[model samples]
Target: MNNIFVYCEVTEERSIADVSLELLSKGRKLADDLKVKLEAVVMGHKVTKLEALLYPFGVDVIHYADDEKLFPYTTLPHTAVIIELFKKEQPGIVLFGATSIGRDLAPRVASALRCGLTADCTSLEIGDHFDNKTQTEYKNLLYQIRPAFGGNIIATIINPETRPQMATVREGVMKKEVYSVKYKGKLNKIDAKSILKDDDFAVTIIERHLEKSKIDIKNAQVVIAGGYGVGSKENFQLLFDLAEVLGAQVGASRAAVDAGFAEHERQVGQTGVTVRPKLYIACGISGAVQHRAGMDQSAQIISINTDINAPISHIADYTITGNVADVIPRMIKYYKKNSK
Candidate 1:
């Protein structure tokens, strides 16, 4: 019998990915529900250093696969490593962070393993089940639930026919486990094989640049997102002012970004950053499925739009129906007066 496996996408220095730790936190509950042990599976050069952090996150075991060949994040090599691990470990459930790398690697791994995978899943729980004569006592019985059809309905997916039930969950939807010094677990260094050759993949890294920011939107405590309704690039300054007063980062909708009002990096949609801030203030943006995919995980959503019927208003915890140009200034005034 295989254990529940969570993929730990390590950074260049071998620190665990934030989303990977979140998966372990979620996986820990799922493993307990199914009466199984939670295991962390890491792949990269010198990944053994990560094992010490997994136990505090409730992992019962850590499987380390270290190879200099696995240093870079490439689709073919990373997917090949995960596929090889699956064959050897035979885990019943596998969880991946729905990051750029995970999005690329997961589909290939799922294809190689011939299994089903749920992507950008916001919510996951063990599915309801009925006893089946053929259903293994501990396998393929849990249903994977996630938001679908633009958060209008919930879809429950089951891979009853497959060995390992796989899923890629969006970052920030699940909480990360804090390091606890009290809990301790075992770490095992595994001998893993490199299944891909240099020529097997056509992609190569020529140069890499990472955008460093003082405030990361995904980890921000407060976010103010501008929508198409913000009107023009100059008008975005008002939203930025509000963000500054509230100490929040600015986010943009796909429409706003495409209109040249903002950079694509600031867009909040399926194609942009997935954020779950404590407070998400949507100004003048109509809620589209793609837009909601990124910000719906926020702890509290407040929308200000001219159209009360805008799709985003429906999901907001509080809705103020009015033009952003008119509404935002009033809010700024009110906040300043009461914020003594």
Candidate 2:
């Protein structure tokens, strides 16, 4: 209960990932509630420069492991560094972003330490629970909340017995905020060379191809999502047109993705990426429970569907009853005319 640690993932651009900062922002609140310090575990080669970014996000101390072998994120060395740090520090709560690297590393470390790990958590909080069976009270437990049963129900998981409660949160599930300038923190450099050995690296990365992605729906300020009602792959262009006018990204429900109307990466739902955009325009989507679980957290929802009784209408801030093809062109025209 001394410190809350966040595993900061460094990008190939030598910058800290946005998800890491988001975790730190949430971890800060948890640390405050627990009266503990908020710490971050940063690992990469020449990553000392990125420490400055961690300070504003409520990080009190940084456990840094800077080494060439740490870059590109091989499982063994990175896991070794994290495991060694956990053994030495014994942090209270450890958080990881449910990204590719986080998903891979968290389970390994949790298994090694014989601790419990909650994956794809949407929300986290500190609270107490009364065990009626034991007639016992557990205080200050980390509540790992996530969608369960194919997003039909929500489940809150707790690791009451574990020393360092661990959870992997999907990106964009939490908001990122910076503390006031009055707050400042310190960093502690770790020697990873001594802890790692030649045999530890069972796998090697001969070459790495970093492809720049075209769509970043998770971080988009405005997202326009389509479903089966959008019709065919060619008709999906209507979504793109609206998105271009709004300076937004295009997203699709699992149905649209599966029907070949959109690429899998453009999917937004339980089986796909979760988004909490400022404005979510769900066009032609029925708002299935699975899709709702991903985007129901948006600040504002505008659902457009011909069916007045569409499930999305229940959660939508504004419901437009119309065909997407007919409605979208008019919207684009109105925006273009008004802006001019």
Candidate 3:
């Protein structure tokens, strides 16, 4: 009830995961709203240069648990550490990255403590809730919002009676920002032996191999996206051409992927990678709510579709009414002409 805690995940490269940094950025704002300190729990082996990495995100205190067994992130060891620390701290809110590790660890911790845990939350906000059944008014509850009912409606969930309301958020959903470069925070080192047991080390990693994806649209500054309306796999080449001309990445809606117009990695929507590019160009996209949830945060959005009344037009800064075949090449030519 005193602080907001973010469970920071460590990458294979021994750096903090991007999602953890993003959570810290969001946690800082939530902590400010609740008038509480933003704390981070970082567990890894030989992890160094943390203050240089985390403090500027407005973290007030850090629980650094360093041990050789912690780096690889086993379910039992990580869960035991978090549960032990949480029992001692009794945090007001706890956040985790909706990653493989988070998916494995958060539920265990929540079950151990009997706390409510929300997963893949698209948004987090602090608000008041009134329980009509109990006639009770609760203040400053974490609103865990996500697409529900087959992505038809957005649901806002709350844990009014649970201690340390917890939620796991997807990467790229929240923007990562720096609070202040000069800000500093305190660190509390935890001894692994006191908190861990022989059972915690029941699972051991003999070897680990990582395969990185070639497509990285999440960090693209400019994105050119297409939908089922893009017509065919051959027509999607126009998006790639336009992207090439503008130095942008090519993205596709789930429909386009389902129709085999693009690779699965290139899909952008609730079920795909979320992006916040400087510029987003949607070609022949109908713009469903799920798709909008992913790229609506882009700095500027341009929708190109024959349907002028399409849902995407509502959020697009500019909407072009035309066929994708006709509009895309002209856009490519215009940008290529201007750049030269």
Candidate 4:
């Protein structure tokens, strides 16, 4: 185990994705535990500017692939170049953000190399394991932990036999931090054209429509979430008003999304995005296990619901028993009065 590689996903803005930076932060810890270098794999048409940003996150070596065909994320070319590099380097561990591009690319590369891949892992760590069936003691294995059975249980997966243990982690599941000192590591430029053939590019991109999303609850420091108890779509406006005053992002449970009270991107749960905000105010939420799996890790939880027996109240740091409509307005008023 020489190096731990993070697949750095570049955004359309010609910047490194926040999830990749988060992975780099976690990978640095893993690399330190294994006594190995933390490396990053960055591929884009013109990603020269993105290379420098990775060092602050504690990247030791950057395997960079810059070429025209690599833009806009076509499956074949990106997969081909990564597979070629993996074959050559044979990294000890590889991590990918469980985003659209990462979900598409990781499985293909794992399949091509005949390696195991754990998708949508919420936790990753290095440890020792004992295989009872094989009677083998595996040391320094990457533990890929995720929610299983619809977030009712957690499962830890290990690829003991694979050379490069791989896992895809969702954004915001891990914290991101920069090292105190900048990493002066090696940057190896890879020639994408050398390994990529004309036939490898089966899919052609005619045009790219990049829509700017307004909501990013995963990165929000304070999240105010609603559930089916919020009632109708119109009543969801209460959440928005509360969020506005609190300077928090609005989140919803799976029930809220399914009931057409909110968008899927605004959903926070096992089936949706996992969030670890500094403050989580769960209003009108029943606190199902699925919903808790996503936000139970918040630093502080304030559950506001009429039902004292709601599952959310059990884990919440503060439980407010009241109607969301009645409670939110008073809170907003108090906040305004106190601030003034």
Candidate 5:
């Protein structure tokens, strides 16, 4: 375990994706544990100029593969470049953010490399110690923990025999390292690929359109989300009232979102945006691991549900047992009464 490599999937505008920094933070810890260098790999058109943004995260190396063919993120060509880099670096641990691009790219890279890759890992650790160091075989070691059975259990997966142990983690699950104005690191520019572009694959992205939301839940400071237990779509209006009072955005669980109670952008879970807001109010939302995977990193979590035994109640910093519709009106009344 000499090197920890992270994928820096960026937008065309040169803005580094948040998930990349999250990976760097997790990678920094793993690198320190294994006494290795942490490297950030950026592949896109004219990406070499963005190296200044990466060094502040405390990454040791920045490998930029600036190629025209990689700008739009095609499958075969991008996968080919990543495979070439992995073969050359042979890093001990490789991490990709469980984003739209990562979800598609990671598998291809892993398949090309012929190694095991765990997807949507919520927790990661390194330097796992064995009970019998000398007598125990080196095969059954190294733990990768993820939520299973709808987030009821934390399953620790192991891939001892694989080189470059790979995993894809959701954004915001790990903290982002703060930037330093004076920090400096090395960057290397990769030459253009010898082969020209070929669009022979069955899948090619035709167009991408950004959704228009009243408020961007991903970057919202405060989020008030509800679930099926919120009663009905009409009852869910209380969530918005509370959100307005608190200057917060509204979010919903997959169950509620899929049922047309809320829009997809407001949904928070493994399938939705990973948010680390200052405060998250989970109203009537059960503490499913999938939902927790998105907002567990919020600075403060307030759970409101009638059932004290609800799974989310245990993880919340504050819990109130009452109907969402009932408790919400009380909350609105309290907030309004306290206001001057």
Candidate 6:
């Protein structure tokens, strides 16, 4: 009754979403720490042979429901399935991806279950908390950590009194790994007709349209990012030039995006997309806590700023004190020269 559950999101391509896979990887660790079996819930059509994809992530139990209405992911029927299943299982902890579907489904589930829900958590761990007023001790609690007070501070939140401690994590915040390629898990088929009702199909999707993203910065091997200190929108061109020379994606801080120096899609921070690149070059970024939470995991960091004491320089493997306008051009020239 008290196991860790991950809602594995399935795409139209009949594959598990990357964020769900990453959650499974983390869920496996949490399950082990709690000495409980890791469980997964997959609701979609034609989701057979998913064991090949899931077991390696250390899932001990898989609750799968296959029905025609399950695909294209309507809000009502899908939510009904999860709500019913969660009630029967009474899990201790539940996790969801902070995607469009997750953002929609998780709150409903939490509200129905009368449980607390934390959104956009950057970190999750098992810890203990003690209440002084009640003189109560809580052990093995799920710690949902994220930025609070407008990203000025990091807050570690815990659900000491709630069952199925719930949180929705962002993509790329957790690393994806296979627990064991040889690992195996048992599957239980859910009766779709028994659990779902006609009223659940009130909302029918008529048509679906998806616009492909122009830039895939998340998967970029190298990232060259700029901030407000980059000067102006025209000055941001230097970052683009450097990116082209290095075959890297151009990223920006929230300040740069607010100043119209870069597009919103290119922003990297708590409110923006999280990225883990092999090399991250920070140009004129003062490195607020929000921005660092997104890119601190980069394999190597190099910060260049006019101020020698910029916050980003603290975490940089190499810090160059200079103007981005001058620094970026020289970088582009030297990189091109070295390539030949």
Each prediction's RMSD over C-alphas, in Å, is 3.3, 2.3, 2.3, 2.0, 3.0, 1.9
lDDT of 1 by residue, 21-134 (tens): 999999988887888889988878875447567888888888777777666677777776677778987998888998877888888888889999988776677755544786
Task: Estimate, for each residue in 1-340, the C-alpha lDDT of model 5 and write its tens digit.
Answer: 3488999987757667888888898887777677788899887876534766788777788888887667777777777777777787898788998877899988988887777788888788864544464554553233678878867787887766677788998776778875465667788766646533455244677897754346588888999999988878999898999988988899999999978898887889876777889999999998788898888889999999888998898779999988898888888898899998
Q: Which model, 1 or 3, shows the larger lDDT?
A: 3
Clashing pairs in 6: none
Best by TM-score: 6
Error of 4 at 25 (Å): 0.7
- Provide backbone clash counts, one per model: 1, 0, 0, 0, 0, 0
How displaced is residue 118 in candidate 5, in Å?
Answer: 1.2
Between candidates 1 and 5, which one is better according to TM-score? 5
Off by over 4 Å in 5: 129-136, 139-142, 179-181, 195-205, 211-214, 274-278, 297-300
lDDT winner between candidates 2 and 6 = 6
Per-residue CA lDDT of model 2 for 126-234, tens digit only, reads: 9999999989899999999877886668899998777789999877777889975456788799999999999779999898888767779988999999999899888
Give per-residue lDDT, candidate 3, residue 175: 90
Clashing pairs in 4: none
lDDT tens per residue, model 4, 236-266: 8988998999899999998999999999899
Q: TM-scores across all candidates?
A: 0.85, 0.91, 0.90, 0.92, 0.88, 0.94
The digit string of per-residue lDDT tens for model 6 on 142-254 reads: 99999988678999998999798999998878899999999999999998889899999999988998655697789999999999999998899998888888899999999
Off by over 4 Å in 6: 211-214, 258-260
Question: CA shift at 97, candidate 4, in angstroms?
Answer: 0.5
Better of 3 and 4 by lDDT: 3
- Compute the lDDT for candidate 1: 0.81
